[model samples]
Target: MFRKSLDDLLNWKNSKTRKPLIIRGARQVGKTWLMKEFGKTHYEKAAYINFDNNERMESLFNGNLDIERIITALQIETGVKIGTQNTLIIFDEVQEVPRALTSLKYFCENASEYHIIAAGSLLGVALHPGTSFPVGKVEFLDLYPLNFLEFLSAMGNDELVELLKSKDFSLITTFKGKYIDLLKQYYYIGGMPAVVASFIEDADYEKVRQLQKEILMAYEQDFSKHAPNEAVPRIRMLWSSTPAQLAKENRKFIYGLIRQGARVKEYELAMTWLIDCGLIYRISRVT
Candidate 1:
């Protein structure tokens, strides 16, 4: 799994005045794996803490914003010796604990020596509900589904990736069949790590579809599990409508398509929720 984000991660690791870094992406896009890989390759150890449904961690940040106390709790929870210079601290699924999200500011201010990386599938959405974001306190890296070049690398086509990056269109045109074949595979597999990994190993289209379906199901479960009760139904409705929405010639996402004569005001929050969860991509027309 040669992720293109490795270059960005390497840059973050070598920066002289680095702040806490946040890896933002859609769910199952390998944010957690990328953090672990970065730590393994660049640091002596990684202190990984997942803030979802962990009572002790939730309590750690409930009362105060002391950086030392938070570090101690993280060390205790992860059993990794916290070294300012060598250890990489990863906060995974961080949106579950709002205070932990805000604590990045203190970390930036008081514990600048420590290398911290944070990632969450719903972090953007969580920050939207008026959560105090660590505005200037952290750096951000946005991860997307594997681009065509990454797909080539994942499938052991490093030479092809090299060629594409070289931009020799005449030579590339000679191998257009190869690129087109891989592009079709990428379309059906769609850059989710698990799906791509399975397709790479087995070359089984049926298994790929099954994995995509499971991922879609997990996303629905996330809505019911983590989203506001009032917004869950709307989210589900908006999410389920995506295939139909994209199938049209004009993919601008009409609210009426979800129902007869539906208005944008009625489904605005639902659309926002789906976008927040990374289930849909929104493109607006600029006149």
Candidate 2:
């Protein structure tokens, strides 16, 4: 899979003063895979540590913030040599351990020579409630579902992507049938990497829908798994209402839609949770 974000990664690698980088995206949007790919291609060796359910790693950070001690522990855990210049350290699912999220600050300040990329599906949502964020200590790259052109490229329609880039309306209009057909496919497939790859290889609409449904299920599972217990129901409510919310002509989120006589005050946290998880897209009305 050719990711457009590879260009951004390359640019970051070439920068003189780079901080720890965070790749933010919805779950299953290939954040982890992209980080691994970049590391494999660019670095001599990569040290990958997933903080989710790693008890040893959780304990490793409870002690002092000694850079060498941390490095030693990381080398033992990942079995990869950690060098300042040639090794890329990836912290996956860092939100599970709050201290791991905060460790980026120390890495930024004391170990600036090391290249680190951290990512978590719920990292944005985790910042709420008592979670302290490492503000101004890391750079971020936001990844979204493949846009229209990327969708075309992934489907082996490179010529169509080239045509869109050219912006020649006359030529585009000449190929309206082809573009419309592909656009409809994108609407149904919706650009999740697994769904798109399946459609590309098999051209199966049923399989595509199945993949999308599975992704949606995984997102719901994440709500209960990662969100606070009190906020879980509210999050699920807001999430379930997203299709209806977008289906309406007035797309602004309405609290009442979630329940009978629902008030914004009641579901604000739910809205925030959905946004934090990248489960729904929000467009605010601007007067």
Candidate 3:
């Protein structure tokens, strides 16, 4: 799939003052794919390290974070020779290892020549309370569900995308019917990468709906497994109410929609947790 972020990664690679990059997004938004794709296309080699459920990785980061030693260990792990100029070191599921997350700081301060990009689905929600994040020592990119143009590209309409991009209203008007049909499809598909991919392969609306439900199920599972115990019920309630909330004429967040008499103070933590997880966006009204 074509991702606009690939261009961003390229720019980061060439930047004179680039820091270790971190990609943050909700699960299933293609963070893992984007990181690997960036490396495969742009770098001579990619040292991909996934920190999920790997005790070896956990132990590596748990020890002293010597940048040289870590680089050597990663070379061994990925069987890719590490090089400052041509290697892309990827830390996948990095939040699973807090010290690994912290190590970005040392990479920035001590080994700025190397290219490093890290991503975690739950980076916003799962950092251990005391973990020292590499604040200001790393750059962050937030990936999101594919937008309309990316969706069109994935559907093999690159020329159409270019036509729209050029803003040639006279030529675009000739294809208005096709564009409207695609717009309707985009509405139903709605840009979730996995779901969109399935629709592309099968052109099955039922299957697309099924995939969306599965994504929602995974999110509910995250709420149970990662959210605080006290907030689980509220989180579930808030999530369940989202569809109805969007259905409202004004499409504004109303605490009372979750349940009668619900208030911001009572559910703010739940709301905040969802926003941090990238599952929802909060738009504040400008006074």
Candidate 4:
């Protein structure tokens, strides 16, 4: 799949004073896939590491911030030769290891030739006021779910996507039926990579819904595991109520939809948590 962010990645790769890159997005938004894809396409070699629960990787960055030593340890861990050449190093779930995130600063200063990209799911929550963030040492790209043009490309409708991009009103009008059908399918399928990929393979609505349900279940599990215990129930309630709220003609996130007389303050933290997790998108109305 072609992510718009790939262009940004290329620009960063070719920049004279490029820092390490951080690809931030909500869970299951294809962050890892995009990073790996970029590496495969552009770099001669890539070393990818995930810091989520690996104690050893955490321990590796636990001590010093020396750029050369850190790079050596990373090569040993991944067994991939990484140098200042055409190599990309990916740190997946770097928020799990704050020191690994901190090391980006040294990477930026001491060894600017090495290319690094890090991504995390709950990075927004991880960078608390007291945390040690590499403020000016990294470039960031936010990846969202596949947009309409990407979705079309994924579905083998590249020509239609090109036509839409060209803004040829007459051509677009002639093929309005095809575009309308694709639009309806896009709405029904949504943009989660897994769901869209599944739909592409089978074109089965039942299977698409099943995969979407699995994604929801995984997200709920993540909430239960990652969210604060005090706000877990409220988060579940607020998130679960989204479908019903949107089922109405107007999709306002009214507090009452969560429960009887649900005050804004009651679920504010939960709403914010969901937003940070990238599960729900809230758009404010224009005054």
The best candidate in terms of TM-score: 3
Candidate with best lDDT: 3
For 180-283, candidate 1 gives per-residue lDDT tens digits of 99898888888888888998789899999899889888888888776888988877877777889889998677777677888888788888777777777778
Q: What is the TM-score of each candidate against the true structure?
A: 0.93, 0.92, 0.98, 0.94
Candidate 3 regions with alpha-carbon error over 4 angstroms: none
lDDT of 3 by residue, 162-276 (tens): 9999999999999999889999999998888999999999999999999988998999999988999999999999999999999999977888889999989999899899999
lDDT of 2 by residue, 181-226 (tens): 9999889898888889898889899998899899889988888777
Q: Give the worst 10-residue stretch by lDDT in candidate 1.
A: 122-131
C-alpha positional error of residue 137 in candidate 4 after TM-score superposition, expressed in Å? 2.0
Query: Relative to the unseen true structure, what is the C-alpha lDDT of residue 52 in candidate 2, on a scale of 0 to 100?
Result: 78
Give the Cα lDDT of each candidate: 0.87, 0.86, 0.93, 0.88
A best-first ranking of the candidates according to their TM-score comes to 3, 4, 1, 2
Candidate 2 matches the true fold with a TM-score of: 0.92
- Tell me the number of clashing residue pairs for each predicted model: 0, 0, 0, 0
The lDDT of model 4 is 0.88
lDDT, model 4, position 158: 91
